[model samples]
Target chain A: MDQPRVGLFVTCLVDLFRPVIGFSAVALLERAGCQVEVPTDQTCCGQPAYNAGDLKNSRSIAQSVIRAFEDFDYIVAPSGSCAGMLRAHYPDLFKDDPEWSPRANHLAQRTHELISFLVDIRGMASVENVGFEAQATYHDSCSGLRELGVKAQPRRLLATVEGLDLNELPGAETCCGFGGTFCIKYPDISNRMVADKTADITATGADLLLAGDLGCLMNMAGKLKREGSTTQARHVAEVLAGMTEGPAIGEPEKAPGT
Target chain B: MKPQSHLFKENAKKALNDANLARALNNMKAGFQDKRRATIAKLPEFQDLRDQARDLKNHTLENLDFYLSRFEDRVTEKGGHVHWARTPAEAREAVLEICRSVDAKTVTKGKSMVTEEIGLNDFLIESGLTPIETDLGEYIIQLRHELPSHIIAPAIHLNKEDVAETFRENHTQLDPNRRLDQVQDFTDEARAILRQKFQSADVGITGANFLIAETGSTVIVTNEGNGDLTQVLPKVHIVVASIEKTIPTLEDSATILRVLARSATGQEYSTYTTFSTGPRRPGDLDGPEQFHVVILDNGRSALLGTEAQDTLRCIRCGACMNHCPVYGSVGGHAYGWVVPGPIGAALDPGLIGLEEAHDLPNASTFCGKCAEVCPMKIPLPKIMHHWRVKEHEAKLSPPRFRQGLAMWAWFARRPRLYRLGANAAIGMLGRLGAKRGRFAKLPLAGGWTAHRDLPAPSRGTFQQQWARHKRSQAPSSS
Candidate 1:
């Protein structure tokens, strides 16, 4: 059979803040024996609008997303938050529309989060030749864990990477408080949540912090860096795809001598 | 009591600065979350029970009128009176009329959120009657003249010292310097004070966990047996419940009760699950002489058949708040309403108005944790979003937030425009913070920068690099 076609939905945060995650997603998809395509017509999964209670704009944006990636065998996103929007919420966005409802439902059926697709759909149990010799902890982003059921898939794959010690962070399933616009809307509450999360991440004493979504990664990484901690945060895909040669998120390029 | 939900942001800020609240919230997180996890893990049939509970609520809600009428008929046949109240004023008046009929001066109350919703104690006070709270948590908050910050744990925002202080202030006749450090000390003092109110009160007002339509009974679950004393010892027992609390049968109530305590306080079953069929019967000696159930609609009936209809299934288990990270951080008072947390964010707008409670809905991170822990599967975040949609359509959202969202949505619809904007923003930000890799303070991002640094863009946008990478590989691959 021909290789399954996968459309990579690079979330907005990953596209701007960290492109390596996008690259890592392509590499992982290719390794899983799927033909990956990046549809430039896609901008976002319309979560901001939908979450902000602006359904008019949310529906309009969701239509463009459906049109861009409808023909692919599966539409995959590196972030569970965005993938959840595509797979679980898009149909609800157009539920009342006779014209767009079926189209939205069609796209929802094909969308999958990156790691879950690799592990569950492609049956890729382990990485071929990747190793990260460091103590690491993984945060289960709320949407990915509760919405798309992307819990064990990332862990199962991470276990196969050579020399990687996965320490389970206490309250690992809690939100990192970078809830799209939530961090900005209610900064006081959001700050307390992220502060608590960073303390837990630091308590693990793991040198590396990993999560599937770049938004959560950026939030945790930013908090960790601001607190003057040495724990580096990166996308789970970066480690799985052997793309750790680059500096971790929020890290400057290494000096020539060092 | 008057619905200060409009001040949620201010309340949240105050709650954040409170060290005592922080200590109490931390303890709650460690205590409630671990207990619920362990309790649910022990029950293999917990998930199946949740499904059944959810479906049963859905059926009852779909036929709410039928079940409510059946409940009224059964109560009347059993010599109990049923009072329908469409507004808070009407509900308050009905309770006052019943009290007047009994010539009651003192009223003892079991833990009831609906009474809190109607602001009953204050109303009773205004009408020249004394109302005492029997539940330990409720009595403690009552002594402090404060609203319940939590549903089941009314005084959860207060630490032991705070309770000790409150008991000292209100129980002035008792020894002020007595030992009150231990948990049992507080309970003992509260029990001693409340036992007199329970026996002397002429009317007892209690909230029903479930109002059975088939058996014409009202069920109350309490750990301290306060509800039983509050209902049985008084001459007149008044069961005040919202319209959505009606259940079709006793078995349905049992199924939901199984999850209620386990989800709320992590108990297998509350210490006392008392069911009162009606007022004192022919052979009854201890129960109340007159029984009255006040069913308040307030604004709940309007919620039926709407997107928020699922919220009616809420059993007031407080599980959603216990597991909620926002509630964990800020505690319940930050919500500035009778009900707080995820369920409050979803249901308060319907109870109160959307405009007044606007901040409650948007304050969430949309974490989905509340719904995950909710036994009835209310889809809390989704309903909160529904309130948001209404707020947006009504133009009730802040002008700046609305404009920002509108601008972003406009650009997002045009992919090419969005990419160009993203490219320019990323390019500039990437160059600006190339040295340190993040921004400690940035313009227009003060909210995020105030708490944590903002990570700078690594490089050009992904689409730009992906285009270049494909161009670089095209010559070799083809």
Candidate 2:
């Protein structure tokens, strides 16, 4: 079997807020025997516009993504929401446009979320034990768990990691409430939801929280930090790729004297 | 019963801060969710039944006019009346007229969202008739002068303590010092009070879970048996239901019924599944003397060809709300209308105008749990998204939100410019919060920073790193 050509859709959040997750994803994909390419023409999965009901711009942006990554044998993203947008919703966006609908469907059919791509597509049974030890729990981002069926794949890979203790978070399937623009639009409700989520995460007594989506990770990390919780948060890819060397997401940068 | 949906945010804020309500909501969260999961796990054909249910509703809705006329003919043949109401006011008026004709002094009521939707209780009271709620949950909330926060569990927003408080105030005839500590005591007291109302009332009003056109039967499922008593004990039985409630056959209703209770209270079947075809027959032992169904369109017919058509397929199982994280957090009243939660977010905009119910749809996280749990396979999130689209197109959303989206869209379309701008923004954020990986506050992001710190970006964007990596890998190319 020849190496599959993979284009990484480093989602807007990963590209802007946490670039390490993207690099971690590349490392994981390469280890799984894929030649990875980060398309320069890629900007976003256009979810912000699509979710905000700006269909025109969502379509245009999706078109650019489609054009950029169409040639790759597979397209994978580190975030479920963005991957879901590309895999599940892109075709729906162009359902009425005769010219673009087939193209959109073609792109959508080839797209996969990172963990699922590694486990399901590559037939990679277990991640190498990175000796990264932590009591960690995984948050199933809504899009990944429900839309893309990404529940067991991440857990399957995590099982192989040597020193990681995986404690299940209560109400793990519930939304962390980042919900893209929902966090900004209805901050109070979003806050209440994330507060509930952090409480659940804390109750698990896990020192670290990991999730596939950067948006949810960022939201949970932000809430945990505000609540002065000691629990650290990071992308699951970072741990699996053995790249948890830097400060965890939302951890403070150390001053020169310190 | 007034459409307070526009005040959803205020209501939600109050709901979140209410400790008693939060406790009540938390209790409901586990029971409903766990029960549904257990029941679903037991039934292997549940998914197939859901698909069958969805298809049945879709078929009935597509030929709704035909099914409705067929239902009317069947009901009329069975010596019953079907009153068509174009609006809530008309439905209320029709119910009032029926009560007036009966010279009814009091009406015993079963739980009916449609009646609450039309403000039937207030209308009946103003028309000089007393309407008594017989369902225990309904009775509790009615005594407290509060609308039901939940469809199936009407008093889910109230704790047992709230009920005890309400009972002490409203049931003045009962001994104040008597033991009212247990849940059973509340039920026994409600039954004792409602038993009298049932015997004396001239009319009974109930909501139909499903209206079968084939048998001219209106079905109501209840655990308390209030719906059965409400219909059978009165001279006149009136059922208020939306037009979308009609199904083609009894078999179809049976198929839907399988999923309904499992999705609702997680019972394989409610304790009582009463089917009333019409007024008492000549040979009948016990039943009402008159049967009238107030079939309401209430803007539902207009939704037929639109993106919202799937909403009409809803079985009112409350599964969507039960599984919703937002509804679980704030409880149902925060939605501020007769209908609440995910189903309400999608359906209410059509029933009430979108402008009034605009905030309802936006309240969701698009978690897809509502649709995942929905018995009818209704695409609730997709319907909500449609409402959002409608709100955006009509310029009903805030001007600032629209402008922000527009500006972002403008930058998002040009990748080169987006990369350049995003790279600069990342660098600025990284330096600003270098000492702390998160910001306690930031300009133009108070919504985010109010309750949580915003995580600062890394030193550079992914594109920059990719560019650097490519240059390093191919030394000769640079």
Candidate 3:
């Protein structure tokens, strides 16, 4: 079979906050026998606009995204929240438009979150020759867990790792309250929720915490740092690609030994 | 009842600071979720049943006017009267008229959220009638002059010790030092007090879980059997229910009931799934002498063909709230309305107007757990989004928020500019926080900084790094 050409939709959060996750995703896809390209025209997934109920801007942003990545055999994102925006919500944005609706629907069909695409579509059983020796737990970002059904794909890949002990976080599927603008809009409620989430994360006693979506990862990592807990947070893609040499998310920019 | 939904943020903060309420909410969070999960896992056909229930509700809602008329006709045929109420005022007036016809004095209520919506208890009290709540939770909250914090579990925000205090203050005749330490003790005390109110009441009002058009029956499902006594012992039984509660047939009610109990409190079936069709008939041993059904629209009719129509399919299971992290954190009273949690967040804006209920739809994290657990399969997050659209359109959101969104969207549409801007912003942030890797505080980000440190970005944007990496990778080949 010909190698599938995949367009990388490095989400806005990952693009700005942690580009390493983007690189990690490319490494995983290539290792799984796929050619990957990060389209230059891609910027954001229009999720901020879409979530804020700004449909007019969400449509224009989505149109730009469609035009940029429509030619690829597949489109994948490291974040499920952005991938869900492209795959699940983009079509609804143009449902009534005769011209853009079909194009949006077609793009949505080809879109996938990185881990689910790696496991379900690409039929990649597990990461080969990759090992991370640490006790870690995974938090299921809401969109990835519910909208994209990405519950076990990450675990399936992590199981192949030689020395990773995956202790499941309590309420792993609960939201960490990094709801784009929700944290700012209702900060108190969001704080209460993320506080509980941090409590649960610390209780797991895992040194490292992992999740697919960068937004949730950053939120949890920030809270953990504020609480002065030693548990580190990182995107799951980084661990899967055996790219844990650098600092974990929200940590000083230096290798541990150095 | 007066709709403090506008103060949602303030209410949520107050609820968070409440230590006793926090303890109560934590207990509820663990109890309801585990029970629902365990009950749902045991039933293989649960998912299919949920689909069927959703379809059934969709069908009935599409033909709501017709089924409602059929319900009225069936009730009339069985010597019962059905009154149509377009607003809460009209519904309250209709109930008052029925009570007046029977010269009612003391009225017993059996956990009717619709009555709360219509402000029936306060209205009755002001109009010289005594209204007594019979449901244990409802009774507790009523004595405290509070609204139902949760729809199904009225006093869920109260711990047992809080209840003991409330009972000690109100039940003045009880032995002052009687041991009310245990759960059974509280229930026994409530039962003894409510029994007299049940016997002396001239009228009883209850909410219908399902109103069957086929048999003119109104169903009430409860664990305490208080509703059975509330309706059966009264001379006049008035069921206050919204028009959306109507179903075409008794069998349709059965289909919904299968999911309702499993979704609510995780029972195979509520202890008493009692159905009352009409007034007492000849030779009937125990039943109401007069039966009146007040079918209320109260802003629901406007949702028939709109984006929020799916919310009308809600069975009030409380599963959404049970699984909701926000609801679990702040508890239900913070929603500041009759129905709370996801259902209130989605439906309240439509009922109470977006300007007043704007904060509700915005309070959620869009976790979609509510939609996932909804037995009716209502897209609750989607409905909330619809309200957000309306809120934005009305310019109800703070101008600062809208301006920030506009600025973000404007920059995002231009890929090159967005890349450059992001690169510049991230570079600055990355440099400032390189030593610590996170910011303890940041300007214009107090909301985030107040609770958690903001993680600084990597040194540069991904697009910039990707472009440079690509050039290096193909240095000689290209």
Candidate 4:
């Protein structure tokens, strides 16, 4: 079989806050023997605009996105959320633009959230079991589990990791309630939910709280720090790709001078 | 008043983002909810009661036509009129006819979602009759010219400050300086304002929680006692409800109530549980002189045999709404329906037609909290999935979405092509994003990447890594 020409849609979370995941994606892809290319002009999948009801901006961005990767053999994301958004909301954005439908359809078909891309498409039932392990609990990010069908991909990938002890948290799928702007908008309610999620994570006694999306991790980690909990938060990609020896996933470091 | 169904998001956004509104919602987390829980906890037989209640409701639903007729029989026997309304228009007409028959100028109403469903207050006012909502929450929302966001807590989105503002704007005569104070103070003030309306009203209208067939009685549960006043004070008391509410016996209804308070507010029962079979009895001191029960079908019967038929199993406990993360964030207004929560998600498609409400089903995170809290154990997420399937089948989803899924479905079936396709994806992404190691925008991905980052596809898909592991596995095993 010919080596596949792959395009990684490294999510903004990894690019801006968690760069190790992006490097992990590249290293992992190289290990898999696929030619990896990061398209330079790529921006975002316009989820904030789409979710915020600014369809015009969303369409404008989607057009740019479609143009950038339209030539790719396949488009993959480390994020189940970004991949889901690309696959799910892209067509809706271009529904009225008659010429763009096929292009959008082609892109959506090739798009994959990393783990789902692994388990469902690649049939990767096992992965390099590098001795990087932890007793960690997994969180099902809303878009990942529901929209992108990433429920078992992360689990399967994690299972293949040599020393990783995967434990189940009760109510694993409940939103940490960090719905992007929803956290800032409903802080009290969001705080309550995040605290509940933190309590669940702490209850597991898992050294690491692992998830696919950084949005939930950041929101949860912030709450944990504010509440002074010792549990560390990491992304599922970081875990599966064996790249967790980094700053607590997404939080920016305290500067030299403030 | 403003045709709220059309501008749902604007209203919901206003409600959701408002810190004042969130503060107002805090009362709900504690007050009605805590009280309800306390009452339910005090009752040991609550689960047994819920089981009986579910069975009772099942029986009523199965024999709805019979129980409804039986209710009609008892109403007629008590010298009250029974109006069978197959639609909202018919129900509205039945109400207008009664108003015109009595030349009613003023109407006092208990908290009733059915009346809201038919736009009764708006219709009555349009027909030139004055209608007032006696339930404090309903009254607050009415004054705000808004729809109730909750079945039980209609003004749940409004804080006490908002209420104080509304009261100050509407009822100016009272010394407005008195802190607008406690809930009791607010209720007392609201009572004084509504007492005269109740006493002088030409008619009273209430929604029936349950209609008992054996005794031909209509039951209403309330915490504030306003439903009783709305039923008792006027010259005529008109009961507006859908056909699904009737049961064969009061004992059956009591069973349902066991779960109702607990699931809704965590209460064993509301403070006031009134059963008004008809108008005032001859010996009754204070009750309406006439009674009328108006049963509205309103597209519910069409749902009877459909896949959505199990949706009727909902008992309006509000637990689904209370536990829904989406509803908790967006509030009920965004659903653009009277019932807005998990129950609202499933029921709205059937009631309003799938096209208008396709967004409702898709709005859920599918956290399954609603199904968990649902006393009936309704599989809300599965039902939502069914709606998505139906949406896809109807070609209601954009053609591009279909083409995308259809293509994925294609590759998904063919394992080799899928693996090649997958490897090709991660390889290309890794190459393009080699510099920054992440692409913020991609051809079609910018729709999402524009707002959020797209973490570059990692080096080879997990399948390639698995292959290496397999080759390595032979060495380890040997």
Candidate 5:
């Protein structure tokens, strides 16, 4: 059988902030016996516009995304927010456009967030964990957990990791306050919320924090770094795909003399 | 009540810094949320009940005029007077007229959010009638001269110490040195103080949890029996309810009641689920002689056929706020309205003009937890999004935000320009923070950097890297 063609929707956050997550997703997809193609025309899932209520531009961006990745057997994104944007919101975005609504729905049906795709769609029992030895806790991104129902898939895969001791953050399913534009719009409240989140994360006494969405990971990593906490943060894919050699997100480079 | 929703950001900051409110909110965050989870877990049929409740509310909303008329008719037939109020002012006047007709000196309230919405208490006070709050939380807040932060838990923003202080200040008859340390002590104090008010009040005004058209009944669920005493003790009983509270049948009300208490306080049933139908019948042992139902539309009719129609299904269980992270962080005062949390975020804008309550919708992170836990399954985030669109269209959002979105959308629509822009931005960001791996501050992103650092970008965009990798691997793969 031909390998099912998957178009990697490398979300804008991952594209700009952390490309390794995108590569890690590609590696995991390939390892699961799937052929992945990167669609360069993919800029963003238009969540920023869509979320900000700019429907006109959201629709245009949705149309571009549909035109870019519609031919692939599956459209997969590393971030739940972006994937959820495609799978859940894209249909609604084009609800009025007779020409685009059906196209949006077609693409939505084929879209999946990366981990859920591996566990639910690909039916991969477990991935070969590349021996990431750390006490790591997973923060469930709000979009992924609530929007995509991605609670157990990542954990199910993580259970097979050779040396990963998974300590569940108390409010693991609670939001990390990286609500796209929300963090900027309501920074004070967002900061308080992330402070609560970081407190919960530190309470677990885990050395590392992991989440599926780069937006959330970046947000958490930034908070952890700002507070001068030693706990590192990374995308769940990097650990699962054995690409953990590089410094964790937001970790400063060592001085040349040092 | 004048809306302070425009000051939501400032209010939220103040709430975050309030240590007392933080303690109260933190307690609520765990107690209510966990108990709700536990109770829902015990009931397998909860989800089915939710669906039924949603459908029932949807059906009633669709035929709202029919159900409302039926309710009014049944109420009138059963020796009750029904007054229709198109707005909050009208509702206030209707209540005042009822009180004046009875020559009421004191009006006792039974935790009515609708009354709060209509500013009924203050209106009555201004009209020269004293209003007393019978519910303990309401009584505490009334004494404090503050608003009810949480809907179900009115004084939820107040700690026990705050309540003790409030009681010491208000109840001058009681000894100041009395021990008011325990939760029960606070309740007992409120119970003692409000008991006199409930008895002395000439008229009682209560909000309806559900107005049953089948039986012409106004239902209120409370942990304390204050709602019953407030209505039964008073000579004139007035039920102040919004129009959307009307349900088709008693059975539908029962189905909704099954989820209401469980969702609100995590109890299988509240201590009191009082269903009052019209005035007392002839030869009744103990009941009010006059029963008045003031049905307030107050801008709800405008949302009947709109995308936000789902908001009308809200049972006001407050499970949404109980689970809302934003609400948890800021408590309810920051919302600066009768209703707070996700429900307020969506509904307040519709009730008050969007211009006044615009900030409420944008305050959310669109986390979807509120919608997830809502027994009505009202798509709260979706409703909030609708308001956002309206705000954007009206140019009510900050001009900088609009221009930023416009600029980003311009590039987003064009892939080539987007990639080029992304490439240039990523290169600059990567080089700027290459050593630190993050920026402590950045131009035009103070909102982000004010709280946390922004992680620096990689050297190149993912698309560029993928393209180069693909080019290098083409011959090897073949």
Candidate 6:
């Protein structure tokens, strides 16, 4: 029936920085027997602008995103914050537009963070295992856990991954202080908070640090490298997709042109 | 106690950006936060303590009517009095009545956020009483005629040089050339000035950090011991505090204290956590003749059983602000309220109306640092999101963002058209900016282009590349 389609929103950061999360999401979705379709016009969830007090531009981008993804039966996003923004923030963003408010609610009701959608909606909580192992700690993305309540979704999905050992990090719910523009605007204070967060990661003695959002991943990774620590960082989708085939953590963060 | 945050920021900016002020703020940060961290690290049950503390606050807020009644009964049983203030005006009126009855000309005050909450100092000054702030930081700001930038560290944004200037300006005889370099020097000077006020003042006022339902005791925690002097040295002791500060028992107060000082200054406990049950008992040499507890509701009771109810859990530790990036930069004054940071985001809506402070919740990166470090572990970002939702429901956000959501809701419900439209748009943007691979200018992207470059998407978007891969993987296609 129409190939039982699904739409994957690989947010801007994922598409630009780590393409494999997109691939991993596709692999995992396909294995679940749903034909995954990524709608490309998704420049961003408009989170950067939305967060930076740029409502008009964020609305324009949100409009573009909504127009692009309108037809999907189920819209799945790999990043919880982006998905949460769409489900949680967007409807609020459009409340006054008499026509858009109800419509935004419609999509907000249907949208899901990847793992939660897989387990809760698609019953992929006990999905077929992909064998790959690494000792790692999970960083709970703020918008995802606090905004969307996906704390259990990723854990259940990760539990299905073969050979992975999980350790708890101190202050697990704490922010890595990758406050988007905050990092650039107040880099000194941002670095202090990130250093504290990375120290907690190291104390876990886990070989890797995994999280749902790339904004946080980049922050933690930059601090890990700057402090010259060895623990690597990757997205939760990348780990579940087994896409860690790259230079180790301290490697020159793949220069953009290359 | 501080005034509303709006005036605080304007004054603090003048202080913080002044090169000398920056040198002072930078030097002081390490000592306060580092010592705080060392204190918190030694406490093994910090997180658990926060949970218990948060639960205590929730319990108190839920049964506020009961606790207030019990506290009133106990306060009266001790030959003291209890007065209820539904609003800040009523609170000011009750305090004024006591002052007028006693023919008080001068009032000595410890750092009390509740007094700040009700604008009591200005009201008393207007009524012709010279209110003296006894805490060194509060005294310095009082001399400057400014508001507290922070809850605990009222003068955190101010440095030693600024304090010396304030002293030089206010205390005409103080030697400006005396090299008042150390904070200790400034503290000692302020101490000497306030010691005189404590002796001469007829009435003392302070804010209670917690009001225990079991003992009907009002608790105040401070490092300077000024709160104790304010209560004990005067003939009359007045306590102005919010209803939410009441907990069922001292044990509960103890639980919250674990997270309070740690989340605030990273201290396991402040030097002083004093509790005053009532006036001095018979045979006590150092105590007040009369005691009064003014329970101010303002806007707290309305918060109970609402989506924003979780904010009632805040112990006002100031951790959320200390660790908040937005707060660290713009500081508390920009929030335009007494409470700032994640707590302020929730509170501003209730106090100022959701419309005026709509941007506060949206101001966060949702980085979750505040929630993490919070002693009470309030789900700050979640409450902020709840505010965002309320902003929408209340039509507080600008019209454009809502319309965008409505349109997105429509397209997000479809699939084939979604893919086709997405691909076409990506392809168009890619081709339009192909040579540059980055758009230097886009009329609609004024907000985005202002800050950072919006890089060009690859010609073959993730979807296009993925489609080819899926086809290649299909056995029939291969």
DockQ winner among the candidates? 1
TM-score of chain A of each: 0.97, 0.97, 0.97, 0.93, 0.97, 0.91
Say which prediction, candidate 4 or candidate 5, comes out ahead on DockQ.
5
Candidate 6 — which residues are off by over 4 angstroms? A1-20, A24-77, A80-258, B1-37, B432-441, B474-478
The regions of model 1 sitting more than 4 angstroms off are A255-258, B474-478
- Model 2, range A172-226, lDDT digits (tens) per residue? 9999989999999989889989999999999999999999999999899999999
Lowest lDDT sum, 10 consecutive residues, model 1 chain A, at A249-258
Question: In model 2, where do residues sit more than 4 Å from their true spots?
Answer: A254-258, B474-478
lDDT of 6 by residue, B185-218 (tens): 8878888888888999999999988888888899
Model 3: pairs clashing at backbone N, Cα or C within 3 Å: none
Please give the lDDT score for candidate 2. Answer: 0.91
For model 1 chain B, the run of ten residues with the poorest summed lDDT: B469-478
lDDT of each: 0.91, 0.91, 0.91, 0.73, 0.90, 0.74
Q: How does model 4 score on DockQ?
A: 0.06
Docking class of 6: incorrect
What is the docking quality class of candidate 3? medium
Per model, the share of native interface contacts recovered reads 0.81, 0.75, 0.79, 0.03, 0.81, 0.10
Q: Per-residue CA lDDT of candidate 5, range B222-256, in tens? A: 98999999999999999999999999999998899
Number of clashing residue pairs, candidate 1: 0
DockQ of each: 0.66, 0.62, 0.65, 0.06, 0.64, 0.13
Q: Which residue runs of candidate 5 sit more than 4 Å off their true CA positions?
A: A254-258, B474-478
Question: What lDDT tens digits, residue by residue, belong to model 3 across residues A1-258?
Answer: 369999999998888888788889988999888999998888889988888888999999999999999999999999889999999999999999999999999999999999999999999997889988889999999999999999999999999887999999999989998999999988888888889999998898999999999999888998999999999988999999887776788888773222
Model 4 TM-score is 0.70
TM-score of 6: 0.74
Give the candidate order by descending DockQ: 1, 3, 5, 2, 6, 4
Output the worst ten-in-a-row residue range by lDDT, candidate 3 chain B: B469-478
How much is the lDDT of residue A256 in candidate 4? 18
**TM-score for the first chain of model 2?**
0.97
